[model samples]
Target chain A: MGREMDQEPSVRTDQQLIEDVRNGDRSSYSELVKRHQKGLLRLSMRFMKDLDLSQDIVQEAFIKAYEKLNLFEGRSSFKSWLFQIAVNVARNKLRENRYHFSDIDDVEIGVNATAESSLIDHAVGNILQKEVDQLPFKQKTALVLRVYEDLSFAEIAEIMQCPYDTAKANYRHALLKLKEVFQTRADLHTWAPETNGMFNEMNAKFAEAAE
Target chain B: MTQKRFYADVLLKQTLKKEDRVRIPTDESFYEAMNNKIMMAIESSEVAPGNKWEKPWVFLEPGIELNEGAGNLRSRLSSKSK
Candidate 1:
């Protein structure tokens, strides 16, 4: 019973987790990584577009964040603070390797698509992904953080190290560009009908964020 | 969102979901690997006093440029050598 209880995720908050790690309960560090790694991995993949590179960046980011844990001031949630480190590490890896996020050709349509139009949805998704991947870096990051990660503009700004308005503008610009892209496509109406629910959700979220 | 914006947002989000499916690791081993990596890194590095990091070379607050001056010094020394 004691062993099983010990195996349970630390009941303490993230702040307490850090305190435990500081107190030399090193296993707590592993527990903390388990708690946060999935989100960090997803965020890293959005930025890097390569699983191998994303994994490396997330690993390095976790290590770096662990190293710099003392600097954390509790101003932001630990998750956001860790994201800041991961984002910076990912950016540095991209710069140092002279790498660019590749076009969205590799996207695999998720299982969430209704079965009837799975093929068509897959094709449209690929096209849209390509456009998003090609967006200016700032706009792409903002969109990913806002739309995909479901982060608020304030958090997006903190992660991107920009003014909140700047983050909002980047997301807005990204949407405008996508609007232009789809408006000119002849089959856009068909695709749009299939995606109405998604649009409604996106709009609702955006409105909520704006408020 | 306006009508056009709605369509764009929907399509963009769908595409993002696709990317998320392809890229995020969902397997058990992924976390295990991360845990191992963290353990290795922490073991190899010198633990700071109080189990906290040494002061970062650059304090990030505005108007703090102490670390920047170090870079400037390196450049100047290189220039003198040349």
Candidate 2:
């Protein structure tokens, strides 16, 4: 009996776990938490950037999802619904806190810097973070879901509570904006041979948008 | 449908991937402790009247320590439940 109880509950689907929880089996909720917590934490970290706050967001998301478990009509996947809850919680936290980022100007690149150097990589990363943080909230959210979470536009729309086209456009706009920022950095020219090709394509796209 | 590829997408993805490798921690113990805290919070809260839902708690206020679960588990499980 102890061995049976100790066996991993991952064999059961999330929906099955939901049913068990609804039937007053609180242990099933623990399984559900175990299954989704890591993913939820990663998603939350994309928004909050602070691990402690991200963990709090994940905890709050799970608790809220459980408290409102009765209301889940199963239209969307449980994962999608849970993510929507976490995104909302993270957004509210952002609104309350008003996160600040360091100025892009603060990242100084040495003339002798190479892509191989950790210093160059760190500086480039700082620049990327600053640019991403500067993006409009909706665009940033769409980009994060698409790029980091690897979620489809349909899923991104469901989570963002926006239309499918809107989500795609937000992601597109984010990439274009980031590309525009990168174009101004001559230091990044040495990063890759593909950099020039990317710049040419981005230039064409920018011209087409202009026309 | 074949999606149109953006040149910048590759670079952005690469940069973000490298950055995320450092930012997101993969320690199992950290997650285990977080899960314990969540379960403890859920276990301690009271279920609202006529509904099986427990009152939602505020987690972010000052003095609300994470591991201690000392935050007020106030009932925000009103119409927001839907």
Candidate 3:
């Protein structure tokens, strides 16, 4: 279903594709864009919450990356470097829109009774996305990169320009904050089966924290 | 463990699961448009070499090829003859 699927066993790595682009192979840049656009678009959606803006962010990030291709010294994996650029672009857009993540207490859930009812009546996923959007920006980015993109903490740190421990802490804080919000809402348990073994694991953690 | 704590923990995991299930739908049109936009930007900046956007070097003659070695030599000889 993808170019990667049709690609031979000896398909070039991202670094190889990047080298080709640097050597004036424009089609290689298209390959690089195809390899990364979906995930990067999702990442931007996490920040901007709008499809058009996310698409713009991804487009700008790719263009900027292409224009500054020479500056890429391969200090990290190409994906991490690309994520770094996307994050910077997302942050700039946030600033332009006057969005700031001040504190955990400042985070506000958009789920009122009407919203929750509409979501529960329709899709539970939207409810969770709204909750995620309410998270502090750093925590949300950490959680999304870890859970959605499945990137390592080292990569998250490089993208976020923070220490590795800070990235881990941000993820931990994000989960805890979401937990705190859900404790009062009994409606979420209906979706428990979907979590597979996560509920049991979480219960064990809860017991440990109490002890 | 407090019953309340357990409930919250479980609920959090449920929400995370739901989040994971969430997928924003995009179509081929979006990707194609983005490809066109990027290609347009790249093509427009061809004069800058290396895909960077910069003012193209002004040349004394339209057909003159700015070969690095030859251009340097021509500049040096012209200055000496001046």
> Which candidate gets the maximum lDDT versus the true structure?
2
lDDT of 3 by residue, A88-168 (tens): 899889878865423334444455776654444344454556668788778988887776675666667767878777888
State in Å the error of residue A39, model 2. 1.5
Candidate 2 CAPRI grade: incorrect
- CAPRI-style docking class of model 3 based on DockQ: incorrect
- Runs in model 2 deviating more than 4 A are A1-8, A106-116, A190-211, B1-11, B19-22, B45-82
Candidate 3 stretches greater than 4 Å from native: A1-10, A99-127, A186-208, B1-14, B20-22, B46-82
* TM-score-better candidate, 2 vs 3: 2
Q: How accurate is candidate 1 locally (lDDT)?
A: 0.67
Deviation in Å, model 1, residue A71 alpha carbon: 0.6
Note the B-chain TM-score for every model: 0.35, 0.37, 0.30
Clashing pairs in 2: none
All candidates' lDDT scores? 0.67, 0.69, 0.66
TM-score of 3: 0.67
Q: Per-prediction DockQ, in order?
A: 0.12, 0.11, 0.08
Sort every candidate by lDDT, greatest first. Answer: 2, 1, 3
lDDT of 2 by residue, A50-83 (tens): 8889988998998888878876755455787798
Residue A60 lDDT in model 3? 87
Error of 1 at B10 (Å): 6.8
Error of 1 at B9 (Å): 5.0
Model 1's DockQ score? 0.12
Considering DockQ, which of the candidate structures 2 and 3 is the better prediction for this target?
A: 2
